[model samples]
Target: MSCGMFDESRDVIEYHPIPLWITPFFFAGSYMKKRIGKTSIAEHKKTLLPSDEVPNYFSQNNLFARLTYLVFWYLYVMLETPRIILYSLKKKPDLFYGYEVYGARVASIAGRILRKPVVTRFQGTPLKINEQRNWNTLYPHGVLGLKSKADAVIMANDGTHGDAILERLGAPKEKIFFWHNGIDINFVINTQHGEELEKRYDLNKKTVLLSVSKLVLWKRVDRAVWALSALKTDYGVNNAFLFVVGDGTERAYIESLAVKYDVSDSIHFAGAVPHEKLWTYFTLADIFVILQDVGNLSNQVFEALSFGLPIVSLDDGSTTGILKNQYNALLIKKQNIETDVPRALAMLIKNKKMREGLASRAKETFASSVCTWEERMEREQKLLNTLINNEHKTSY
Candidate 1:
């Protein structure tokens, strides 16, 4: 069946336009349910299946609790797989389009049983598949084996992820296709929250450095704070202020880092702004900084480019195609991030001409290549249509 495991309503936003019979498995909270209800998917599509609810005891913070949670979750998956297989047999779908890992696993198994093609899309770096290691203990060989069985594997971003799939997971190279993430360019450009955001943060005369992402270790938000501190001490850039937008587990640790660096006053933690309001922060920023070491591309990078903000990022695999050194963005050498990041930030902060040059090129690059959601949707549709048509042909 054409199925997906819904992590959030945002997942629907990407795949919504595809003209296919879709049944989403909602594993989100009540707020996400409300969000999904507002979408056209809720009205047009078949009823969404609710994921098996686990007990509150699973929430306990201990090894036993964690293992118990995994055990229960695996049991739920095992129980659900039969239902999915039965549904697939009844529907005889052209192909299965799996969104997340769990969905992909279910679809892979179902596809194998029914002798149907499975197209799985990896939105982010697949769990435990990165430069650091070839294998993830959490994912295990069985999960990877199931993933490798897919007829086609579509990655949301290019670069390192494709390599990870082929080299690490032993997936066939021909099955891999890279579709760079896109954003609503006009929406970001026309969005007008600059004045209000500036006033809210008292960013009247200060040069604002914006980082919009989840507060996580992989994101290296602490490094961003350290860069800000260096921008002051090393480069003598005191007027520069950082506005961190988004919240996660590392928020407290990041806050402590800011305080430790004595740049707490300069760093404004505008925790978890609404997605719609993100454009304002993007528009108001003097420079966009992403210290993410993992994942090839981010929606924030595209959004920042769309908003015409100059970017300074580490020259890691994630920024491979999207960021060009001294072109669209200033990519610092990852080896010397502690020194190079501050240098890049200082260079952009001090030189308006350079910033404008990079910003102009960045916008031009985005406009020509990854501009809007429509363009991305069209590409995805083409890929999906090809897969479905091929499946039909093979069946006939």
Candidate 2:
């Protein structure tokens, strides 16, 4: 059975194509419904998007920038969504799950009005968002309104995000299920043998330090560059080099910082590589660094773990819960760079055995403890099924 927005040719659900959002949950929902022999529904907003999602216009003088989404995207969704929904309703799907952050509210409303069970996954706290003008209008009160109406809300990570939804948004804590944002362990551990990956990246005799998130200020890609600069200047680490994968609005700014720090020649910007090819980069790296000030359990960190590489990240967001200091990962305190990051990096670089030991533990953890794509789908399914099976037992 196909559910959500399944693209049959890709054999997967089309989630977020652009980086404005993360769509793993959408894929998770589709995979579950497909396995269960049920179909899921993908519903778009009934009205035009609030200015929050797309605050800027094509051109400062363009008249269309001031026009309502109703005149543009809304009309398109209005024309397409109903036909899709009606066709599925006529066939009577076993379950209807709405996925994604912005569109989940509309899906929940449709499910309620249609007398069908609905489940929505909440991945991050309102605090974790970029807080730019466009995002403010797009997700105003977070997804609290829709979550209140939803039968179940699945949280991708744990702690503060769930606390905000329950205490601030009034969502019942019991109705929210926390699923660790996971990676494909097998994909990482069993990637194309190490030698071929090294040759492809030309990583001969170079100690590769990799950062794999979108180049954004909050992510602090500059911090990695600063650390690399310190490595060269303070420790004479001539063999160390850094590879930054993924692109975003901050690309130019990051490049500028690298040049300013005089480490431009030591860094590589490999933009927006597809998922399949990511493992090759992972295999080439000796260490992975994630310096994002917010959010926990980044996808890049997990992919690094699959390759048995030691990970270094700030103990903020979900990072604290997902990783332990000096265990599977090396944890640095937030904003304690003067005291911790340099010390940690220096320690890891100086002690090859310790770094490799952490890598082995990380691999073992990914294989034995971390959830895979299939496990994540089942966990999401259980939450949705529980919501559907006992809809009236709890108040919204």
Candidate 3:
């Protein structure tokens, strides 16, 4: 089971080569499924999870409300556990794989009953905000046991998240594996959406700066707006424009910041473009900026690299391990967001040769390293096969 939103209309499951049986906690329905054509994965009956339609005053800060919310989800998982166990018994799956913390707990329970090895992939720091807040604690008695119970705990990145698992969850070192996210290079290279967007947005002859991610507060999209203002005012980058793709709760706030900075005209908020159609925006970009507070490796960074776009990001765990300063990309110190982000952007905007050099090296790095979706899946498949074959059972 995966916790991520699986909207068939916007997201394409075909990119994932593995033959999956997805049981998403939240799904957009059969109408969208039919539109996307036959998916590579089989869809299971959607889980009856609690909806996020709480009253206005029912806030996360309220202790009673938080506990009630947690209890409701725990009960929901318990209700679904029987179905999971029965399904495992009937299908006899080689292994049980869960995507997030909630799925991990459910799969772990089912795995123990069936005595099958369980693998849980933590897409982000487990028990972090916006998801389960107490996943580290064991359910019912509220003890710490989820990480210890899993046969193997996979992390999407080996940066901040991996460190959190080791230090916070106390996960065994050997039990952890880092599977960096990968991109569809062939799709990125071949897919093309014509100048319809470019013409509509008046992108021609403008130095295009792109940032693609959900418009969330932690993402610090306001920083992009500030940088745009800095570029024009301090750096004399009049022809440059920042295109922010993706939407979230912070849309109005971000727009307000743009107005305050007087870069509203320069910063184009291209709200939530379809995932399949993102290649067009990628093709249209000259440089990519990711102003996330924690610089974990993002899918947008991989997509930008696949298109050979020069990237400007902060020097932190999110980008440090993957991007090298003055090599594939430029990494600014976090303290220097005000001085350095604009400086870096201005430098890239003015220096055509430097931009091409960084972009070229970035593409080369992705091509030579583990950057393709097929390679990522291959590693995961091998790991699953190893666990199923019971080879080096005690090693993990």
Candidate 4:
């Protein structure tokens, strides 16, 4: 089953093509459906009512919101519950899949009731929410109830998230899987670099250190700038430049920090650019550095790897999975909230062997282990087939 809001993209595709780019890139995968479950009908039994949307504020703290979400989720499963009983129940699809944790948890119960499988994909900060937060006890400890019921879990980050699942959710070993979000490597690398970008930023033949992401608190982009500044002062890195990509709430603050540090000329904020044009930054950049503290994985890091650029990043949850100490990346740390990112970059520039070795290994990792659109489909199809076939054999 899928969440109803996911289909919201169809409305965008119909209304505005330009805005459709904002839709989640993976929504195209909705076409590949096995079977979804539904909740029980206490009312008309024969009719399954279509669900409605609830606002974000309602979901924030109200007890009714929690109960309604749980019940409607079960209702969703009731619409598809029969699919598990009969192997031929493929004429109509099952319940809708919800994208959030609350909806996914309720759907897990529906999966157990209907003997159908459920899988939840993680995209944001892994396991950080399991601690004693404002809404801590709404679900089970570490959200184990959902994990126990779910057939499998899909982690967008690396295997580092496996700990959060096991410790907080109490998920079994066999139930967890990893999917490194990747992009079109060759297509991105082959794109023509915009000459204007090079000339405007004075990045011609300069060893460019790139940071392409939203300007936000946890991203710690200031660390990258700090490193670049140090590289220039300590190592006489006159040939180096920093290309900052994307715009966000913290744009003004970041720019102000650049000026305060007296490295404004060395740093250039390119702002938000189209996806096609984003590749040019990679094409022109010599290295990429990301220091996200929350999410275990990022699209920017994948793009960097796809373009065969060496990465320098902090050892946070996002990079802890794929970024080994010295293999695929130059992993640094934040000492008392002050990162040694500059030291990491300085070492890389001094040792060309380490830089080339990291780029080579990252490319290999993307080709063999990272998941692409084709690979995701095949793996998902195989899992669904196995789940469906097992049900058939049990019935016989």
- Tens-digit lDDT track of model 1 for 1-396: 124422121223112221222222223322343443222322311221111111111111233333333443354446556777785565556666665555566666766777766777776553434323523333342344335457777777733465465445567777776778677655543244666667766888888999998885556777788888888899889999999999996698789888978999998898998767777777779899886655536888888878788888777666776789999888876667767888889998889999999999989878776747887878776765676556352211
State the lDDT of candidate 4 residue by residue for 1-396, as single tens digits. 233211122322111111233134223222221111222122421221111111112222244434444454454345433432242233122322323454455445544544455555454323444343533334322243244355666555542354455435466656665566555554543244577767777776667888998875446576676666677777776677888998886688678767866789888888997777788888887788876655535777777777778888766545754667688887665442243566677777777788889889888866666667677767855664565445431110
Global CA lDDT of candidate 3, please? 0.65
Ranking by lDDT: 1, 3, 2, 4
Off by over 4 Å in 4: 1-98, 124-126, 129-148, 158-163, 186-193, 316-321, 336-339, 392-396
Least accurate stretch of 10 residues (summed lDDT) in model 1?
49-58
Cα shift from native, residue 46, model 1 (Å): 50
| Per-model C-alpha RMSD | 10.7, 11.0, 10.5, 12.6
Per-residue lDDT of candidate 3, residues 1-396 (tens digit) = 331111123322211111232223223222333344222211211221111111111121234334433554465457656766775565566566666555666667766777777777766552333224544221221222245366788877733455454444556777788667877766542243536756765878788999898886557777778888888889888988888899997688779878977988787787987766777778889999886765447887878878899898877756655688888788877767778888999999999999999999888877776557787888876777677778444312
Best-first order by TM-score:
1, 3, 2, 4
For candidate 2, report its TM-score.
0.71
Q: What is the TM-score of each candidate against the true structure?
A: 0.77, 0.71, 0.77, 0.69
Candidate 2: give the clashing pairs: 3-40, 4-40, 52-134, 52-137, 52-138, 296-318
Task: Please estimate how well model 1 matches the true structure, expressed as its whole-model Cα lDDT.
Answer: 0.65
